[model samples]
Target: MPPCASPLLLRRRLSTRPPHREHPKLAALLDVLNPPPPSSTPLPHALSSAFPSPSDAFPLRTLPRLLPRLPSPLLSLRFLLWRLTASTPQPSPHALSSLATSLPDLSSSVPLLLSSSPQPLPLQHYALLLNLSTHAGLFPASLAVLRHMRSFGLVPDAACFHHALRAAGSAADVSAVLEIMSGSGASPTVPVIVTAVHKLASAGNFESARRLIDKMPEFGCVPNAVVYTAMLDGMYNFGNLDGAVRLIEEMEGSGLGANCAPNVVTYTCLVKCLFGKGRVAEALGVLDRMAGRGVMPNRVFVQTLLEGVCMEQRVADTYNVVERVVGDRGMSSEQCYNVLLICLWRVGMTAEAEGLAQRMMKKGVQLSPLAGSSMVRELCVRKRSLDAYHWLGMMEENGVLCDSNVYGTLLLGLCEEGHLHEASALGRKVVEREIHIEASCAERLVELLKQYGDEELASHLLGLKQRPGGLSF
Candidate 1:
């Protein structure tokens, strides 16, 4: 075996051999048993000499150091990332640690190669490794990689710094990183500045975070809608809803000089902040203002509103919020209204949930499975067959409750209430939809219709088996 080959590697090689061929290959392999150490040549020479065939395995440990000499090093960086991010059986912690430890030197050398290549360097390599290290809870190593980028006169993008900031141990470390980024002659992208603000906010240095927003101009990236939105998210997460409001006022009244005024997203984040602090009434006011400006809440924003209302059990405000969002353009997803409706039911506000369900039906909005089931069940129990049919029709139109017995149950309740016309209409629908009910229920409905001399209704009920609309499960 070669001198560098470990016992495990020898076993691996032998395991791939056929029993008969092992003896023959063993003799040939023995001829090249003693291998020399890696050469002392520089990386450019080493790589140029090594890559004629490109598939040869070399010492993985030294590749990062040698990578800078290549015109476009990402070719090899791709291989490195493949090893680091693979899921089924990941690389050893020791190996990953070793690779991350070498990042600074790799980043430092990368800039030297950039002067020759005209393409935008795929610096995502170092950033990706930094992200993985940070995700793996290797914060110090992630920071080391950041410093390495600076040492090499390289600038990592916003996403790279996002991971580092999240992994930061304290507010001070966050400030130190921002300082390094600013001093490194790296032109800060807007996202990078926003990430810095977010990190500082998370670290509870609200004062410093606000200052960073003010200082964004120095980086030649004026705060825009996206940047201000980040600040709003950070401020809220840091538990300073009041500060978030002040920042929004500042952005609106004072202006961010590049249309940084609170748009829908700004109001969206503001709405979250308001509801986060139990200011549900105030959140509604913000929504009105946003809508007045011709920018309505998106699905994500409305969903956030629903979540906060549910979390705090804000029963009184739930209906109004649901009504407004459901009636708006582009905000009324079935998921959003369902959460709002379900929140009402979860907090014991059945009356309010029923009211909202009625409103959703009027608007032709789809109901989620749970919401649809709850409303239909409650309406039927209240002997409100008309309302149940109305809402059920709405839900059916929206293509939900397809595989549920709830429709069958609702039909039975309608029949029992002696609303023969409504019951017959639903019976025809059941036949058309091919929805399943219990055998006895179906037979009872058919027998009742026949006794009442409603031959058409009884025929529809009996024809259920001939249709292809049976419920799926």
Candidate 2:
């Protein structure tokens, strides 16, 4: 056996372990302190006496569980400051959610959190405050939190900056966030710069936005195609079509490299904007230029062009555009026609839409999910949900995925038409796929099912509605 250790040696050995252990007495003290502010806060002598080792560090692990139980946000915040010194065991999401909800005004609480501790708060905690403040729509308070972080020499990472940017409501708000980023010596990335520019331009602060874009090189950030695309979007959104056109021309003439070249998105915006102004010929020219540059159009580009022409009641022009894109071999003829099907329905060309639908179904052409959904929707609108239900079966057999909205629409239409057996079959499909429908649709269907004495099926539909992770609209 080893010799017994001396008292000082024993103390030193004990100190190597975690400072404090989970203690029932401390928890009891906290429980008894309900709705009572400590005359002296942050482990007052009364509270400290309950700890096994009064001189030991606070038990940080117990704080997260006890946070919600605390009577006031101030007490919880005080405990948080104490634990911020240690890096491990960050606050849990539930704890943060509770704390954020309890605090009446985060703006005031931020300063209190900052001033309570002498040592710098961990960057994570500051990020938590920023997230809470911004998510609450308290943009000014979020800015203040960021300012305090900079004052403490803490630099926020990209994600934290994004949280603040999302909450920014105007040009001034965006500028303030950028100023904080600059002051912290954290260079904004290209995406961050684009978001800032978009925000500024959206508020009609075009000059400020332009200045930011021009100054990108100052921070070693080059404006890529995406950045230029955002600028074009802003100009078009603000009714500055000419400005957008000129910007695209400049982008085309810049000859910087592929990074600066107009891609599919750039051409899409130009086409949509020009089409919006009834310049169909000019829009076609832009598409020509895009093809000439060896930039291929994607599905969205084709969809936008089809929708634009369809909106103008240019049916022949619509088919011509589709044929032209199909000939380019960039997109399949089936996908192009699927998009045209959606466009035809949108423009209320019902006869043409029905004829095209019949041809596609007879040919067993694989229907895109959007096209399948569109066909079901149009049939239901004509009070033909029986037909919609059959259509869904065929689409499913062909392996076309139908989304929740499509199912819900058909289910509701069937119930409204008193087609119980069909609605029941669809509801079972919903449960089999574990899909969620709108709450309103589910409730209505459930009521009709129970009224018709289908108790078991009704409960299953309710289960679908209450299922975890189910997508509802």
Candidate 3:
């Protein structure tokens, strides 16, 4: 008998008799001797020799036998192997390659074992596979792992599903993710579904996004503030303002507050929709309603309203809104003044605009380039040429550098008003300071001189232009 068969012979005897023949005892012995060919060979001793001692070896040997007696020997063996190997210091590339080569059959059997096993895969393995699949962009392989997870009666938590969805979204393969969820009969929570909807909306697949929203209830999903906001933003972005408003109304009817009190996004979205439809009066009414319901308009909302008023040429109303925002503690001083100056300038109210600029100056609020430029243009438009000149002089004197465009505007305005002496002086100052004058501005100045019948001065300006280096005058 083979040396390994000694232990079995001590436990039972065998004889050379066919089991189907008349000798029943001999047949039993023959059956014991020949035990049908093993379904699989035992893993090599070297592989199993990962254990530190012989006492540790008994469990590996007796585990299959003890499985019926001890409930989870396979799990215990897996744990032991992982503890011994995976938790050690990081493996060298050669070690990893050797392990990979040695475990080819084991690797093939893992999926089969995982599929047939009643227990879920260990958390560590799942996490490792997830990270691998993400980096590799291996969607099909990831789906296989997730399928095995389900087969083992495991339910992934929200975070697991969220990460998987994010991976699929990154790969631009949303359908694969959908199929996995469908096959598992698992429904992602509101936030998970909203995240997917947002991705679809960004991809310009509004119809699919809407369909996903419609399917929310079937998955026992309810739209929270985030979900509602995502849907509203999607509809608004796609020019489905009416649909966005209807969703708001539906949210209200479902006992979600239509009042802007708890949900500023819904109210803001509605306000934007109103403005989009050119319903300025209705939009203002909505703002008032938002205010009454204690939904304080954020900077964005207030800015939108101010912009609408500017578009509609409602300067007085826009100014009122700006004042209201300035009165609020949270709004930035710079943004408030900037929008106010723009609205004032848009409606030809240079006087009011100048007042705003003076207020900002007194308060030590820094003006944005846009606000500064707008104020300067208003100064020139009102024929306050000296005011424009003084403002530019003050900016330079105070060491506040203005953009070249600001200087260009001032020079062009001075020339148009037949102030060639001042225009030439300013042009010389620009050239001396190395401030750039666009080619367009030079041409415009020449045109202005011809229009004013100052050909001699125009020729002088033309001569200055021909100089090799920029001239200030």
Highest-lDDT candidate: 2
Worst 10 residues of 2 by lDDT: 464-473
Give the Å shift of residue 323 in candidate 2: 0.9
Q: For candidate 3, list the clashing residue pairs, or say none.
A: 427-472, 428-472, 428-473, 429-472
Candidate 3: misplaced stretches above 4 Å?
1-209, 212-242, 249-269, 278-282, 285-299, 310-316, 358-366, 378-387, 394-401, 442-473
lDDT of every model, 2 decimals = 0.63, 0.74, 0.59
TM-score of 1: 0.52
Output the lDDT of residue 400, model 2.
Answer: 90
Prediction 3 TM-score vs. true: 0.42
Candidates in order, TM-scores: namely: 0.52, 0.74, 0.42
lDDT per residue, candidate 3, 1-473, as tens digits?
A: 12233424523433322332222232322232234577252322323434344234332222222212211223323333343344444333343333323332333334444565566666656644444344444455456667777766676666556556655643256666676677777787887788777666655676777788778778886546667677677677667777777766666564654332236677777777788889888877765666655666676676677777777877788767766766754366677767667766866766667776777777777777676777676777777766788777655554556666677678888987767777777867865665655556767877887887767655544444421123333
Overall local distance difference test of candidate 2:
0.74
Instruction: Point to the candidate with the largest TM-score.
Output: 2
lDDT of 1 by residue, 102-195 (tens): 4433443233433334444346556666655665555665677677677677777667777776667777877766777667656667766777
Q: How should the candidates be ordered by TM-score, best one leading?
A: 2, 1, 3
User: Scored by Cα lDDT, where does model 1 land?
Assistant: 0.63
lDDT of 3: 0.59
Clashes of 2: 0
CA deviation > 4 Å runs, candidate 1: 1-125, 150-159, 314-316, 326-336, 339-365, 368-398, 401-473
Q: Report the lDDT of model 2 for residue 29.
A: 42
